[model samples]
Target: MASGLDDVIAAETTLSDVDGANGILVIRGRSLDDLARTARYEDVLALLLGNFLGKETPLIQSELGVARAAVFTHLAAVDATILALTPIEALRALMARLADGEDKAVALQLIAAPAVFTAGLLRLRQGLQPVAPDAGLGHAADMLRMLTGETPNVAQVRALDTYLVTVSDHGLNASTFAARVVASTRAGLTSAVLAALGALKGPLHGGAPGPVLDMLDAIGEGDNAEAWLGAELAGGGRLMGFGHRIYRVRDPRADALKAALAELKLAGQTPGERLALAEATEVAALKLLRLKKPDRRLETNVEFYTALLLEALGLPREAFTCVFAAGRVGGWVAHAREQIDHGRLIRPQSRYIGPAAA
Candidate 1:
């Protein structure tokens, strides 16, 4: 067996391709460079869902609007009992109410639930009642409006939209594999999505971005960056954002998000001092990483810039992975459908290495 399923081809998908060696990402026949600059979250969702819906898929922008409102109705269940847990847990508890099924309507709910549920949980945390979703707003903009209970700043909306589109889908990574495994068992889309969320909750996966902020907060200023990063490396601590598991070169998503943050800076949405500090820290960390471990390919990854952009968008650090779920849910639903219609049950054989023939 391939340890950790390394270099394994799990499934055939027209959804997205992750070229780790070349540091490129392609989603549904479009390069990430092409999509990140212009596509809205709804556009990527339509592209992903269209794999199965084909000509039958109506204007998903409005349909997703309806789906957001439908998922909002469930916020009533997010009472103090559920709120007692962490953000992702509370969101998961609320989301579990979505009835398990594989229909197009069910798929839409899975796609839309993350944004609505995340916004509701955030509002309720601040002693505010959940805001209703606007069926007229785009997914990323509406999500921001609901989170803050106000109109979204246009530049910030573009930043968040790029974030959602950038992360919409990738090849079968851990969470996607978990999703597909459940789908192969004929679990409904909701079930598969929940499995993916569970996998993402782990720190090694979707949990990394929040800590990027924690690292920045710990550093606090540009002056302390080199010392902080140096100490981190000396003590064998991994710099959270400087390295990626894939992409020996720079992560393409990092450039995409950094450019988005630049837009926020250009619009004066995020403070310039904050951007300068982050840039300094990134430079210092990269230098330290190369000096300390010359053999390893430790370059800037997506999580580094993700923390900065989402913070500028005003999302709390704790809800970082929930925002991730909001984007990745599109891929989960599409892959689940793909597995259901086109693939067999996923059952891999083991080598029986443990206490064989006892």
Candidate 2:
């Protein structure tokens, strides 16, 4: 058995594709670079949801946005339970609160899950009371407001959107697979999303970016990047943000997000030379890796820019995974709805090898 299920095809899908050799990610029919910059999160959801929900209606974006606002006010029910628990527990509790029904109104639960969960985690971790969402603001704007208790400037909002759209979906990765597995059990959408959240909280998934920032901090300023990376590699430490399971070339989302972060540079922003240092370090490491591990194809991935952009956005290290969830909710909803419409029970058989014939 491939314990990690490497190179395994577990399901037939009509979703995104990860073409590492060609360095392309096609979601639905559009390229990731095309959509991350142009399409709004709701627009992509509408595209992914497709015929799953028959006769598409208008105001989905507005509806989800408004629904997201409404859900924020109600997180108090779970706030007390999970504040003392781990983030995954908090996230699960939040998902339960949102998933209490199957009526069409449950669509609002899709919008509410990420915002409420992320905001609540931030507040609980910071020893502050969670603020309710502001209905007057857009979803992205409202999330920022809820997290910080203050409105962000326009550049910040755009940067957030860019990051969100970039990560919104990426084929059937680990969390997506976990989500599908939960959904296959005929679980409610909230349960599936919570499963995905638990899977994602692991360091091997979206949680890796938070430590990437820590690595940068440990490296201090630009002067130490190369030597620090070298010593870490010699000790067999995997550089946090550099490589990916897919995208053997370069992550398209990385380019889009890095551009967004560059555009949003604020006044007296201390000019984080981290990006430049990272680029140089990546190049040096890639050259060295090619010489060392000649058979393995290692390339830069989305976490590189994800760490940079979120850091630029003033998000704390602990909030990185939650922020990732906030961006990925659209993809989760779209995928769950698509599976319900076009897919069957996701039952996969495994050949058991341990203690055989016992």
Candidate 3:
């Protein structure tokens, strides 16, 4: 048996396609590059939730924006105190507090919780008051506004939106599966969201990007990247930003985010010398890995560019996974609502593994 049911296809879905072998990612029939470059978060949300709702609801966007703005009103008192908690904890509290009813209000709060929670958590951690959301702004744009207390330029907003949309939905990913499992029990939306957030906080999901930065830092200015990476690999430390479980080739989201980072001019990097050095390091790592492990197809994955893209957006590494939650809230809510519509309790059987027949 493959441990943990590894490589097993557990369920059929309409959510996403992860073609690691070909380095392609298709979400709900759309390429990630197409969405990241062109579609707004709202548009992508509409696409993801389209099948669940049975109709397009323009009001969802505005309603969610207003709700996000309104929730910040309550955080005024504990704004400073909450900062002491980790970002994930702060997000959990905010989501629970804002969850209240079955009307559109609940839905809106669910939609807005990620942005509100993430932005507020970051500012609170910085010993700064949380910035308010601008209801007139798009979801991604307003997120930046709340985070920095300044409206992002068109390019900046676009880049952030692309990042949000790129990670919005993937087929039965660990966290999404956890969310569905929780949702299947008919648990409240906030509960399911918190469960999903907890799943995301793990290194296998949310913690990968920070180590990518650490890898970059350890490499020290790209000059010693090759040698440093070689040493790390030789020492039995896995490279932080390469390879994927599902994608046999490259990760499509990696290239998409990389392009967005380039477009925003936010790589905060000198392209020629530094970029060339990074590229050389990447090439060397790949060559060495290939030569060293010919049986396994280890290659670059989404985490590499995810680290660089979020870094360019000025987000601290600690907040990366929370930001992922911000984009994914839509899909989670939609899936929750969808599961509730069907009303099935998730129950899977497992073979007895401990003290069998005792």
Q: Between which residue pairs do clashes occur in model 1?
A: none
Q: Could you give candidate 3's per-residue lDDT for residues 1-358 as a string of tens digits?
A: 6876677765556667777667777777988878877888888777776654323546546766787888777566465456677777777767777654334567667778788768877887777888988887788888888899987887778878888888888777788777778878866777777778888889988768878877777776666877888888889989887877877777788788778767756534324443454566677778878877789888877788777777777889888888888888777776666666665787767878788575
Question: Model 1 compared with the native: what TM-score?
Answer: 0.97
If both were scored by TM-score, which would come out higher, candidate 1 or candidate 3? 1
In the range 176-290, model 1's lDDT, one tens digit per residue, is: 9999999999879899999999999999999999898889899999999999989988888989887776678899999999999999999989989888889999999989888
Q: What TM-score does prediction 2 earn? A: 0.90
Global lDDT scores for all candidate models: 0.90, 0.73, 0.75
Off by over 4 Å in 2: 1-3, 50-58, 78-81, 100-104, 266-270, 355-358
> Looking at model 1, which ten-residue stretch has the lowest summed lDDT?
50-59
User: How big is the positional error of residue 187 in model 1, measured in Å on the Cα after superposition?
Assistant: 1.3
**Clashes (candidate 1):** 0
TM-score of each model, in listed order: 0.97, 0.90, 0.91
Error of 3 at 133 (Å): 0.8
Between prediction 2 and prediction 3, the one with superior lDDT is: 3
Off by over 4 Å in 3: 51-58, 77-81, 100-104, 266-277
